[model samples]
Target: MVDSLEDTIEEERLELMVSPTGGDPTLRIAHFLKPSVTSIDGPISNLPLDAHSFEDTIAKPNIWASKVAFNGWRNPQKQWKHWVHHMHSLHQSTWKEAGIHEAVMNSTFEIPRNDNLIFAFAEKWCCETRTFVFPWGEATITLEDMMVLGGYSVLGDSVSSSLKNGELEQIHEKLIQAHLQVTRSRARKADQSTWIAKFVDSGSEIEHEAFLALWLSRFVVPASSAKIVAKVVFPIAVRLSRGIKVALAPAVLARIYRDLSLLKDITVKMKTLNGNEDDDNDVRVTSLAPLQLVQTWIWERFPTLRPNPHLIENDAPRMARWDKRKKVNSENVRQAINSASEHFLWRPYAMAANGYLPCKLYKEEAEWMPVGSGLDEEVSSLARCVRVSELVGLDCTEQYLPHRVAMQFGFDQDLPGHVPRGEQTRKIAWENYTRPIGDTVLYIPSRLFEADVTKRYLDWWKRSIFGGHNVTKTAREQRSSSESLKKTVLHISNEKKADNDLLVPPGFRPKCNMVEVSFDDDDEDKQTLAKLVRKIPTESEKSLSRENGKPSLDPQVQSPSSSSTADNGTVGKDKCHVKPVDNSIRRKLAMEDSEKEAESGTFVHDSVSISNKAESSSLDACETPGLDLEARIGKLEYAVAFLKAAKFGHRSD
Candidate 1:
């Protein structure tokens, strides 16, 4: 009777879940119906394996000349803060207009490179899946990571969208010429120093565009040279100058994936060579990707491997959590990483102290939503991240597989289905990369769900790891080697602790105290200039004050309450300030203002139309004042007539 009942329960469970081999796209609930059963089996894979090979690559006496040195971007100087200060208010207004203020703000915070930590983590990176496989499970840096850590927007026009044979193209050409004229070079490119000197405070109409161009070239997709590539960056910079948003996160992620593959290939080759080659013939690899992002990802997910980070301020970007320099001993990184399974943070952002706030992408319940279903931008962005699609970059493309790591997105895991990589799939992925596919629905899982794998998935994982392999022999050998290395490291640590009582304990790493550093007279001058700029009033604010028949109040003398009310919405008598007006209300007000302008023979494009080109083409064609008024009026009349026809046709039906 008990066996019969167990069989009945299994049948019911099978009925509720779709087979992994089935063609259905809808996600099943079977993965979440039961709790995960821990497998008693040993390490799942060779991952978190010995890191001696990677450590030895960097352990050479001339470590600075090693290939791993090129893993991260060149650190910018403290003086770079002056450039940020110069463009502070302009950047705020421009990025807000472009609908990328959140991303832009996050990009400004500097994350100091921890070379030892990065190298240690890179050893475990699997190039095929673009993930770091560990003993517990697989984890990867995804589009979500780019959005959170680097402040790149997932919802925007493709990076390949360029100005083509339009007024925009003319504008782009003129901006390119400005760079050439500033540098006085035959080449179209300009060096960073020359670009900054020419455009920082030039007050020219193209100053903002030039600044963005420099930023993209240096920070976003930098090459080995110091010169900014006008052809690659200028078009996007021009679009941004016109307040157009570009999907930057996908492209950034593609570059990271490509570089990581290259880094892995070179590292494998070096390991094979085993120091047999001469010094002159040694292979030196350089990774152009922004590896600081990879380091930050590891720091966020691995508690044991993380160094002490800086305190984060309210409303600041999460990247600000690592703004301080951290001191780490390279020697113990392998041991820490090996034992990180118990200390790993599966969902770090869910914790309030991690400095992540609930955004629009978060949902309370799991549901299927059609991509590009005229949904909110945040919802659409989240859909793009979760879907199995191809990520297009400037020079490369990569496949994204969120289904395999469903747990990372706060969903329970089952056995992941096969991902189709045929030519037809690639074509479809490219053509509809930023648009909605016909009748296709994307799974938007809830963050509130418990992230765990089903019992069947655990069993399958164990079999895959232990089956067809001599697990007994491999486990024994690995255990023996790992223990020997640990004893050696522990003995060395003890000797060092005895000699100098300052050595940290075996499993406990203390935080480094904040230290103050003195600056030069040039730094003081930059600070003075920044303060003076803050005191000056913007032209619009000055005009508004003059119209109101009152002198503008000095910013420094303004009361906290008045400034707070003006910056945010009006404050309440209660402790918490009143919520700011919703986006819907703001859009309604903007439409009303546009209608008012329209009566005066001016047609202002709405934000929605500006973002969607198909909706804006008619308005764009009528932009020139030289066009006949009757022609412009006829276009509007035709649109109104078409809408009336559609309404009457619907009513008749």
Candidate 2:
């Protein structure tokens, strides 16, 4: 027990000496930090000490000087045992001063906003140790740095007695810097990830500007809004980097932003809305990096290629007509466009937040969204009425500028193609998502990755049996056989190969009019009827030879069944060998089938058209003699059939 106690005392002594220089075990630990923090609350404009009274004692902007002093110092007394807790306390101070805390920021986003908003987020901390030490001269101290440390010091000598509301005392500058180095050294010990290393390492820069912005946006002034950062990049770079060409990148990048074209008319409306014509609407700003340059280009071009087909139909109704020279098939383009417009070109972020996922938001529907250049309408559409706040995941009722800005700061962090991982990432969303899966996972939260970027496609129908069209409860279904329609109208009718240019050739369907050669069926009706059938787009018609009135969709299209050719192809090429299926009688049978179809609401069963006449059991309808007489008559009929075959040379004479 004595040995263990001695070992602990040794450990404590060495730990206390961590802030001192010259890495030796025997050096005395300095009483570096003894502080009594007056408080960490109230507006930036007002200070605890009256400036008039302290005018001769302090420098101009005493608060600013004190902050500079605090940054330069740390606890010389070695008060904090946990290194992480020490780092956390320093980080809290940064956040508080950087306007991350609410009281420091200006109400209007106009001016006087703190520049380092991210570093200002204050944390809850209390030190009941009641330690106090005021720095006198420069053993390892600057007046500014020492004054800043006083802002967080606990006063008095005992833990309970010095538990005053506030006190101001100094901390050693060496200890403060030493603490940061220690944490970074520990972070590098085991292999920590890149992001983790940055957070722990003092030398590491804040790579994610958006994260800082998001935290600070809630309280910072509006001058540093995402929009403004977007604009001032060039000049800001010029100031920071001192390079003319680097400064010009923002302008070049800005020009690349085609939203300028969208901004022209919007500027006018914005000016009117704000009651200020002098407003510089041309200055569209954002903190998003240059990668967004490509995204901006795509956003501009998408509106053209992905315009609602209905818009073209309404504007230039003839746009849907077939144009062979154009590489894109207009109808297919129409379907995809209509689908895209309904799905917002697969950008379901704004819509996915809601329950529904209709494919596109059409131009007519989008008219309300206040999109792009030129003022054609007086009233704005549904898009403009929408607020960025609704998408912010929380309410910002009052004017807390930093927090608001912070909310949007993550915009730049919404990295393209970045897949999020981890528990919190799983429970909520931090990455782009895909379509829903089953009842539990109904919605995907990912950004709208382009289809080309999606990398894989799967056959949707093969996984499940369609059963039949009636199985679907969806209302959009119709009796149209779209699959068959394409083969007939597109490939066969135009006589084009499936892999070739779009027109389907006529060899597939030799005759569009399967009508029998009886007049009074007007030519107009025949043309109209042909057009209707051709419009189906899938029916692959071809040269058909048949034994009866039924038309077979066969050249090589139908099955090998012998009964298939009994349809609309030329029937009975020879009278000799046929089983004597009377042509008129077969036609009469077809008429009866048609009547039954009409009465039953046209739900024609598969057997109705496909069954052969030989399969029909209509014995009672046919005239029959007595049993022995009927047998003799059947024999005579067979003999007659044999004689007819011989006469036509169907059998050897």
Candidate 3:
């Protein structure tokens, strides 16, 4: 017992030395930071001794040196730990000076109007952990936890009031239902063949739930707000990447665009309606990265040809570096401009005790946001330097500059091959897309790839499908059968507009009219008709004779007054004869006789026509009573016309 007690005491002593003041082990692990804590060169030394002296701290600015100090700094882990501790101390001092805690505790108290106060409040509040003590136990909470716990109290009352109360759960439910509907409906429609369909089917339940939750959160408080969407959605989007390739569906994308745009416009209107004279719109001032804002939309509507995961993972780190670099460059430009304006450096800091940086720093020219620029020379040449606060005017222009620029000059309006921007993309959507037949592929132009930087987008997309690139082979064949080959091919050309010079051949259908002749009343006419039918070769017989290498011969062309001749040219006479027919019947036969007469007088060019005429004449002279040749001829004409009508009259009917 004694030995154990001694060991415990020794351990407690070591713990005290390692982490003094009962602070977190992580924050307390700063040896080198201790020396700089009271150094005259340090930022804290510049602060007034009295923490509550508002005039000096609020008026002055301070650049919070990065924990890393420099890109080339050694032992980044240790250095960052120390930096966090120093920044926290600075944050607490500022909060004390500004009485922020006192303001939050009171419902009626107004926050400081200074931008620095708000900025520091938000930054420090986010980074620090709050200890909430209850009667039974104590709980450590992060900013997110505080957001849920405090709700309207933590987020401004205006935001809470503006949002529809109790709509969050309803929205989540809607999103879940929509996701399930998309998965099942798409799977059934495409036979579970699409990549999205298969992913939903094969993915674990946890992954699917995580995706739904992450996507639904986009409509929630912090995520919905453009200021923090990058910080919130980016990580979630990356986490859900394995199961879901696209960030959001097309419908969801449209909703997000409309919502964010409306929110920005509505904020000012709301303030005016509430009788607040503070007409300054803060929404437009914050720089929301366009690519990050509508990431899902870009992935769904304008998918890249290839996905480089390694490069994508590097974005956060690169953004961090760029942000730091831009801040330093902007400050340098500000200093030069201030010198030209003949203002003394009252306090040499980027941020005051409050969170806001002077607006002039942000208003520096786009060119000035880089290193090695002769800012001193440029500032000297300027006729005048505007006041720092006027820089807020530039914020309105910065709100959606990237998107505005892209729409006006990018592929949102005009596209290659003279095709419109959204048409080609919309065609290939899951609900409406139809695969083309026989190795035909969609060709999207390089100009249309403004949103996606994939070199071979089509090829990569084809490979991403479940059945490789040829998943839609059966669908293509079905489409080909339903539509004519010529029409189908032309439809593709017109829709894609990949080549304006493409020519579409006209479609055609062969015309076939079935001939029908009625038997005359006379027995002789009936007999002649039967004889003619027997003389004509059947279709099969004709084909068989051709296959046997036999030449086609015309049927016997014997007139009523002449004898019939065989294929070998031997004459064969028939004893059936008839008296002269009635005038009406003769008139019906007149056209047939006239044709024969014309053939005999004029050299008969067509032997087939001559044979038909001779057969008709024989039928006219058949030995039978009351044969109505006129009626038979009229019926034949009517039958041919009706056949043509039946073949092509469905459209009008």
Candidate 4:
């Protein structure tokens, strides 16, 4: 069945390529349909040659000395919550129809930045290929990352597409006028704060439009300034407000690529200067891209570097997991990245969710699907994510290469074939960027399974220059240190357990020294357990009383034959005698006490004060002769029952 699907997909791909009006006439299909290479004898073009050089640059103490900034834009104000709620309530169906409900809802969440982590990752990014070159393998922020983490859509109209009618233009003009009216200035740019204060909950027709403008300006493609560029973000906001779907993932990925390239270039320049430049001439490079996505990507892939993220419910945006910030220094982050080969998660999202349902694009069975203009939205989206193409953003155009990291897409990795990047291919053409232009045929795999690499790819990876030699040495050192730490912890725990065991008597010792008890809020069982535990004598108290020459607390050691007990007439004074009992008798007594307590609705408080008082009163009884031993034995049995009941709850007979 799978073979038939593959054949059908291949036929469709060929038909589409040969059709006169289907694909790009300037480009040839053979360029993309080339198979993976088995081996390479020389250096591959565009691949990073020296991994250690880049690693050293990032590890330097003065890497941040060149005024690098990755600060994110200001979040939406608290007062804007009302406007968001209103828009959600009023246009819930429209947002969903446009496939941006999750994006809009997710925009409200604040994703705190970890500048150190982002800087560490950006240092390793290869600008030519748009992937972070690690010793383990190649990995990059793909369209899937943008879609799943940033809540952006992979399938929609091009972000560069302009409105053909004058209605949207008029609405745009009204928004500008409103901004001008609020600011009372002739300046073209509108202050973000002023715009939100004037239009949020104003009950005007353009309230929704204004709210979307704020979202785009603050979140989608944020600027360094606090002002909103009406000419840039207003049109996209108007389209989104009118239920028009915009392909945001590509633009987002493009901007990230651009920022990463910029950051990498500046770092390289700083490295070239070797810290010899004057401080007065330092140039500050502030990134305007949404770098929250970059930080979230790092958190998802590298487990050791990130904080413990909050677990969200199923179907929630995955980005919500990292809503808090963690403090990290440059030294630790550099060390973690250096030894991240063994810990990098190639397919982080392949793990089964707690209660997740499979979306339309993901399935349990692997099959080949043809994706293009006429295909399903999910299929088309998947194709766009897995294909190699150019991503066009508002300000930049960057290359997208999914083949170098095929393992990320659930495909078996092979030697990556060279992808030609001619001038025409790099052009920022909206029509080329909007559709799934590369590899019309793609293999979709089950979400739960991760396909391993081919033997040839593995062999090539071992010999690849991009794989750093220092990575193995650093990883081995880290592993050895962690193992020694674990052994030290285990040794301490063992000594503590041995010390605890010496204090407990043989028969009364607990089965497990570490007792884990959990109780619900305000539960009756919890109160009952607490009362019983308070009554039992501690090991220290028992040892102290024994040292003071007081009568032993163990009921078995005390003689039952006493004159006071004989007066009760419970047992004949001459017939009754002390007898030794096994551990089974104590266990049976506890079970009987639990049953009685449950049936009669009586609670027994075996408190330390009560026991001390009883011992004091019975001091003479221990010396008395001709007393009934059986009558006194019953009292000791009751005391033992409380101890057992406190430690272990009711047991089945």
Clash count, one per candidate: 0, 79, 13, 2
lDDT of 3 by residue, 472-534 (tens): 343344333433111001111122323322322234211111111222211121122222232
The sequence of per-residue lDDT tens digits that candidate 4 reaches over residues 285-385 is 77777878887788888888777777788867776677755644545787787678667777676664555542555555444455456777778776677
Maximum-TM-score candidate: 4
Model 4 stretches astray by more than 4 angstroms: 1-35, 39-46, 50-54, 58-66, 71-73, 186-189, 224-226, 275-280, 325-330, 370-374, 424-428, 435-441, 466-653
Instruction: Show the lowest summed lDDT stretch of 10 residues, model 4.
Output: 484-493
Q: Which ten residues in a row have the lowest lDDT in candidate 1?
A: 3-12
* lDDT for each candidate structure: 0.52, 0.20, 0.22, 0.56
Which residue pairs show collisions in model 1? none
TM-score of candidate 3 relative to the true fold = 0.18
Name the regions of candidate 2 deviating beyond 4 angstroms: 1-390, 393-593, 596-653
Q: CA lDDT of 33 in candidate 4?
A: 19
Cα error, residue 179 of model 4, in Å, equals 3.6
TM-score of each: 0.61, 0.19, 0.18, 0.62
Question: Lowest summed-lDDT stretch of 10 residues in model 2?
Answer: 121-130
